[model samples]
Target: MSEDNPHSSRGSASKTWLERIASLFNAEPQDISELEHIISEAANRQLIDEDTKGMLHGVLDVSNMRARDIMIPRSQMATLDIEQSISEILPTLLDNNHSRYPVVNEDKDHIEGILLVKDLLQFAFDAEAPAFHIRDLLRPAVIIPESKRVDALLKEFRQKRYHMAIVVDEYGGVSGLVTIEDILEQIVGEIEDEHDDAEDADIKKMATNVYQVSALTPLDDFNERFNTTFNEEEADTIGGIVLHAFGHMPERGESIELDGLMFKVSKANSRRLLQLQVISGKPPTATEQD
Candidate 1:
């Protein structure tokens, strides 16, 4: 019958294969679910890496997430009062180590403008100057609604070249703040700059035996620093080891002995320990104390 068309047979085979693949995929190839599966498959095949996938996922999530979800909570925000003196403002900025801070008057809810820490350097250099008012150095604050999507916020930030925004609730009260860096961090992960505090430093020797140690300090680093043999491959941080030893979350100021060293929880919350004050030497056992 007209020399059995080879092209028609090949076309039929391609259609069948595509239909079978679509059946296995369980969704239309052009749909969002299919796209996610494609990305996962690409990751599995090593065609695209995990980091790339993570960033892609982050970028996608930004469009879906709102300002309230990612904005730093008000409790954690380090704000500057425009009425404060240079001495007070300088120390506060130095302590927090932030580039920009929300300038407020009366209270945190009455935010006036953004303060660039570098602007204070001029006044710091010339303490004898007569007309260096804090209000003069303030940049116009960009206030955004809590419900604003991060994607839209990022676009506005880019268009206006604004780095920070004050997030406000429906009542127009200062809820919190969000930064351009925070939005980018979502897409690319945490951005640790030179000014950022070292999150991975070992036990900082504040004194001879007493030290300020992060709960996240590695067990190996802790052991090597203290010259102890408290080894455990199952745990990474000393906190994890402590948790394993205690079998529960220890409250703040709780002291416990492990591997001959005593650890006192210096900074902790309802959830977990932040920092511990460690002292070398055996603590008194319950039996010995009794």
Candidate 2:
């Protein structure tokens, strides 16, 4: 009989245990927002305890964040060019640790489609063709504007049964690309695949409190591991602050000081800085030199 409604019995039993534990601790288990409404509705009814009401508010604080909250800025995206050969492109494609790469014409701004390495691998083993063109193996790339919400993007990915999107900025230039792995990393954690090189950007731990962190570490992952949580709100990665601190887009090795943190651009391209290093444990002082 319990098998038919297993969760029903389990939940009821758990609630009963919790009610007893509440009594043992001299705590009331009543919901608070309802208590507030009841007190407002009738003068005779006493409201729940203040502590319980405050605790309820804490639970309500954790709502879902937006796409912009965790998006990789357009400058940081790694893309593949269409003209590159199968033999020439394979090393780079494998090194990035990505299974699918966005195929662009001459500029990343003009994404042609998505190329799956798996398709090329089959022909590589067969030795039937002298060379395989990336265009022949690619599927039509899905393009979306930057303003689209992550919730909407996830739904679109599901509906279309696709995993990658070419993000276009307001000017119709390639903004960046977001993958299902990127979205999933936001919740569970970073997901590394076989394509990712083992020695790749894996930070070297120097000290328990002070260690070396990679410039490419996303602000999201860095915050969690270090317990910054960005004071519970801010740019999702350290990279955001570097861009903000410089007052302009930064170049490789351009160092900026903020809140006692020295973010030095360890790696950069003409478009964006690829990596930064956190220099100290203390926050920056106002008089500190740039």
Go through the candidates in order and give each one's C-alpha lDDT. Answer: 0.73, 0.59
RMSD of candidate 2 to the true fold? 13.9
Q: What lDDT score goes with residue 163 in model 1?
A: 95
lDDT of 2 by residue, 1-290 (tens): 76689898899877865564445336553654553343333332333455444333322211133444344445555567888887778766654556788887887778888988788768777867666677888899888776777667777778988988877777888766777655654433345655444334444333222333454556666654544545325564566656766888775446776665566664443334444555667543332222
Candidate 2 positional error at 60, Å: 9.3
Alpha carbon lDDT of residue 115, candidate 1?
90
Best candidate per lDDT, number? 1
Question: Compared with the true structure, what per-residue lDDT tens digits does model 1 show for residues 1-290?
Answer: 52498888888877765664456347534455555665666678686799987776666557667888667656457888888877778767765667999989988899989999888777667869676668989999999998999899999999999899999999999888999987887777656667555532445544445566778788876666666677658688888887777778776457888777788775443335556778776432232211
